[model samples]
Target: MKTLLMGTAVLAVTASTAFAAGHSVVRLGTEGAYPPYNYLDDAGEVAGFERELGDELCARAEMTCEWVTNDWDSIIPNLVSGNYDAIIAGMSITDEREEVVDFTQNYTPPSPSAYVAMSEDADIAGGVIAAQTGTIQAAHVAESGATLLEYPTPDETIAAVMSGEADAVMADKDFLIPLVEENSGMVFVGDDVPLGGGIGMAFRESDPEMREAFDSAIQTMKDDGTLNEMIVKWLGEDSPRF
Candidate 1:
């Protein structure tokens, strides 16, 4: 799970300059707290699956790009507000989100959302369940039989479960995997659920050309199998791919 801890001051300067056709400049916004997708590494730089994938897509699209870190809760609103050129975060494609922002073709397959608790004995059927607010996972929790507890960030959802404020937390399986592996106190339980279509880049509704550019670049990578290789490298062998 990822949390937002810093201000957007440095990220505000990412899209300050613009370039022409052969040297187009684009700013990519990401939540640098979700591991294997986009997260701040030990060097305090954005690193992981989306970082590698976004760089390759930029090269193929002939765009000079830079990364910008943002909190997950406000990521979409900031994109629509012109804070960045496109969102390269692992944003799932949904009709609700698509109504506000256009999305490129999916680069990653649909991901399975999972649940985990501090102990296997923890109640997951009808007890308090935690999830990040504004996400599809949170919506699902609200509709499920369990009592839903919303948090501003993904990290806080897990924190709630660990601190006994919540019985379990639901989130992307890829996100909970590494965390569960490292902490013996945590264990994944219950059947996994799939939500949304797949992960894609988001752009302002007026920027259809930007979406098409990235869509074409993603298609090129898929055709040559580069996309699949990178998916395995960062998301583990069992992760679904293009």
Candidate 2:
């Protein structure tokens, strides 16, 4: 997960207004930085697992959708303020978050968080750890014995480890796997930590109908096996499904 301020302000539109009649335009918000989940393509448009999955869900729900990018930290706040309809970012479903926004049935199963360091000998439990701010990994580190260093972006969390500002970086195993493979200096350390329930789309509390529509669309994908195919395609064949 990551956060960055959008260059322009988006017109506020509630799900009730935008998604009227279960077949109207609904703006989908995401952090265009988390790869294999959501990220910006070379064309500067949002791409990755979320983009393809969101588009399919929109079509299945008979709704027109537009993508919007928002800072991850302010994503929930902006959703509450009506800047967008639903958040399709790789957001974890948690009681703490549900108290503020409503979540659809989970699209992805629970993922494990892992640590990456320059050496296998790194002290994953007691050493300083870097994590993207506002993410479940960050919360886990804050509670763990390790010193927690928070960053605004996933890249920065990796940077903190590369620069030795922190002994290791903690993030979703899916996100860290490719990075670890590409970087000769980085290696996974510590046991994989499972946190949060699963990933889901988030809507305002007042938009129960809108949430239900997408939830049904998600279930359709699961039933047809399309969701699992997509998950394996982007998140590796070993990724948890359903």
Query: Candidate 2 versus the native: TM-score?
Result: 0.93
Question: What would the per-residue lDDT of candidate 1 be over residues 1-242, giving only the tens digit for each residue?
Answer: 12231333334333332222334888899999888799998899999999999999999998878889998889998987677889988899999999988899899999899999998888888999999988888899899899999998788898999999999999889889999999999999889999989999998776666778899999999999999999999998889997
Which one is best on lDDT? 2
lDDT of 2 by residue, 195-220 (tens): 99999999988788899999999999
TM-score of each: 0.90, 0.93
Clashing pairs in 1: none
Candidate 1 lDDT (Cα, 0 to 1): 0.87
lDDT of each: 0.87, 0.90
- What stretches of model 2 exceed 4 Å from their correct place? 1-14, 21-23
Q: How does residue 72 of candidate 1 score in lDDT?
A: 88
Residue 239 displacement (Å), model 1: 0.7
Q: Residue 117 CA error for candidate 1 (Å)?
A: 0.6
